[model samples]
Target: MTAVPQPTAALLDGTALARELTARTAESAAELRRRTGTAPCLATVLVGADPASVTYVRMKQNSCAKAGIESRHVALPAEISTAGLVDAVTALSEDPAVHGILLQHPVGAHIDERAAFEAIAPGKDVDGVTTASFAAMSFGLPGFVSCTPGGIMRLLDAYDVELSGRHAVVVGRSPILGKPAGMLLLARDATVTYCHSRTADLRAHLREADLVVAAVGRPRFIRGEDLKPGVVVVDAGYNEGNVGDVDFDSAAARASLITPVPGGVGPMTIAVLLEQTVEAAWRQLVS
Candidate 1:
C-alpha cells in the first residue's frame, strides 16, 4: 500500500510581511515629506518605568527614525494621578506638530487607562484605543485601527486567508486586541464570536471557527487538540519567555496556516503604527 503524504502546516511568516509593509511605509513617508516639507511625527506617551513598556516605546521610536518620521516622547511619573496623566496626554492631542499619538498600556494601577486614551484626539489616535476609533473600525468607516488588530488583518490579507463568510473565533475581548480583531473580521464579512475569561465551552467555539485569533495574553493557553484541522491561526500574545497565547507546535501541526509568536503579531503592530503615523500627517495637510 502507498503511504499517504503527511500534512504540515505553513508558517504565516509575519516578520517578512512586516518588513514589506514597513518598507512601503518608508516610501510613503518620504513622498509625503518631499511634497509638503513636513515629515510625519509620532508622539509617544509613556507613564511609567516598566521595563517592557519602555522597551516597546524605544522600539517604536527606532522604527520611526528608520522610516524618516520624527518621534516626540512624553514621560510621566508612575505615581501621577489620573487627572494629571490625562492632562498630559491631552496636551499632546492638542499639539499641532504631532501627527499620531501612542500611549503605552498598563500605565499604573491607580490611573484609568480609558480616560488617558480618550484624551488622545481621534484624528491623531494611531494606536486606535479611543471609542471614536473603535466605532470607525466597527462600522467599517475610514479611521485608525487598534495597532495589533490592524497588523493581524494585514497578515491575513498578505497570506490571502479567506475571511468572507468564514466563522472566526477571537479568544479574548480586550479593547485593543480581541474586540477590535473580531470587528475587523466581521467587517470583512466573517462571522465573529468573541471569547473571554468567563467564556464557557471555549473548545466548542474553537471547533466551529474557520479562523482562530489567540490574544488572551495567556502563555500557551490554547492547545492543539482544540484547533479545527486546516484552521488559520493568528496568535497575538507576547508573554513572559516569548511565549504566545496559542501553543505554536501543536496548533501549527493542526492548522493550515499559523503565525509565530516572536515574528508574528509583535512586528506587525509596529508596522501598522508607522503606516498610520504617515497617513495622519498627510491628512492634516489636506484638512
Candidate 2:
C-alpha cells in the first residue's frame, strides 16, 4: 500500500496578510490626507454589464472605502466603441483627483482591449494593465504591479516562502496575471517557467515546480496528480463563486502549501490596489 504524502509546506493565508496590508493602507491614506489635504482616489471603469466585472469593481470600491480612499466609477454601454472606451480611460488618466485607475478587463470582444489598457498612464495604472506597467514589472522596477500577481508575491513573502533558486512554474501567460507573475518570481531569483494554452504536457512542468501558480481561468485545470509533493501553490484565477484554476481538494492534498480561492488571492488583490492608490497619491503630491 502506498502512503499518502504529508504536506511539508503550510497554507499561505492571504486573508490574514491582506488584513494587515489593509490596515497599513488605511493608515497611509490618513497620513496622505494630512500631508496633502486630500484623500487618495481610485477610478474604476467598467464597460458593458459583465456581472463578474461589476462585482469585482464593486469589491474594489468597497475596499477603497474601508481604507479611507475615495472611489469613482465609470460605467459604459456594451456597444460603446473602442475609441469611446479609450477616451474614458484616458480621461481618468488625466484626472488630477484620480490617483489610481482600474479598467476592468474583458471589456468586450468588439473593443480593443490593448488600446484601452494602454490609455492608462503608467503612474495611475494601479491595476497594472498598461504596457509601461508590464515592462516595469518585468524589469523588477518600482512601479504599480498587476493586483493579482502583486498579491501573490505579498502572500509568499508573508509566509516566508523562499523564492531564491527555487523552481517556479506558472500555468498561464495572460499579460495581466500569469506572464507578469512568472517575471516577478524570476526577479526574486526563482527559475521560472511559463506554461500557456500552447504548452505541451503541462503535468510534466508541474512535476518539476517547487512553486506553482495556477492563473488559468479554467476551474480545476491543475490536478493533484500533476503536482509534485510539497510544492507551493498560488491559485490566482477566480471563476464564479470564488473558484480557482486548481482543483483545491486534490491540489491541497499534494501541496505542502496552498492558497484557498475566495479568501486567498482575491482579498490580496484589493489590498494591493488600495495600497498602490495611496502610493500614487504620495507620488502625485511629491511631484
Candidate 3:
C-alpha cells in the first residue's frame, strides 16, 4: 500500500509580519523623536551605480521616511579608491546626527569590501556586516545583527517554531546571510550544519534538517523532493524575476511552513534595519 505524502505547508506571510513589525518600529521611532527632540538617523553609503543596489537603497530610504527616521544617502563613484570610500564612511561614523550606517554591498571588484565595511563604527553598523557584529551575533551578545538573518529569527519566533536541539541546515555561506544565520541558530541551541558551493551531498543534509534556510543566490535551486517531510523552509534568496533559492511550489507541498520570495524575507530585512536604527539612536543618547 502506498503511503500518504506530506500535506501542503502553511504560507508564512512575511508581508503581514513585516507590516506588523514595522508598525511597532514606527511607534518606537516616534517615541524616540518625542523624547530626544530629533528623529533617529540612518546613513546609507553606496559605492558605484549598480541599478539594483540603487533600488535597494531607495527602498530603505523610503522605509525610513515612513517610520519617521531620517535617512542620509551618500552615493560614491564606481571608480572610487578603497581608501577614499573608507574615508567617507568613517566620516559618517563620526557624524553626531547619524545613528546607523549601511554600506550597500558589492561596491566593485576593485574595492576592498571588508575595509569599507570596517570603516563604519560598530555602534553604527545597523546593517550588521562587520566582523564585530558577526562575533556578537555568534556569541549571542548585545549587538546589531545582520538585517536578513535578524529578520529570519523574528519570523521563526513569531510562528513559535521550536529551535532548541532542532537540526537546521543552512544552504549558503555568504558573510551577510548564510554564515550569520547558522551562527544565530547555533546560538539558540539548534544543531546547525552549513552547505555551500563545495558541498558534495546537499540533499543528504536537507533530508535531516528540521529547518532549512535557502540563501544561495540561484533561483529555485532547492526542490521539494530534497526536503524532509514537515521541514520548515525559509528562502532568503531574492533574485531577479522575484524568484527564490528554493522551488516554492514543490517545497511548500512538503514543508510545514515556508516563506515566499517577494513578500517574505525582503520586508523583514528592511524592518529590522529600521528598528535597529532607532535603538542605536536611543543607545547613543544614554551612552
User: Which parts of model 1 are misplaced by more than 4 Å?
Assistant: 1-7
Per-prediction backbone clash count: 0, 1, 0
- Give the range of the ten consecutive residues with the poorest summed lDDT in model 2: 2-11
**Model 1: clashing residue pairs?**
none
lDDT, candidate 1, 104-165, per-residue tens: 99889889899989999999999999999999999988899999999999999988999999
Question: What RMSD does each model have against the real structure?
Answer: 2.8, 1.9, 2.3
What are the lDDT figures for the candidates, one per model? 0.92, 0.89, 0.92
Write model 2 residue lDDT over 61-109, tens digit each, in one string: 8899999999999999999999999999999889899999988888889
For residue 25, model 3's alpha carbon misses the true position, in angstroms, by: 1.2
Q: Would you list the clashing residue pairs of candidate 3?
A: none
lDDT of 3 by residue, 1-287 (tens): 86645448997788899889889889988988788798999999988889999999999999999888999999999999999999999999999999999999889999999999999899999999999999998887899999999999999999999999999999999999999999999989999999999999889999999999999999999999999889999999988899999989889888999998889889999999999999999899755
Q: Model 3, stretches more than 4 Å misplaced?
A: 1-7
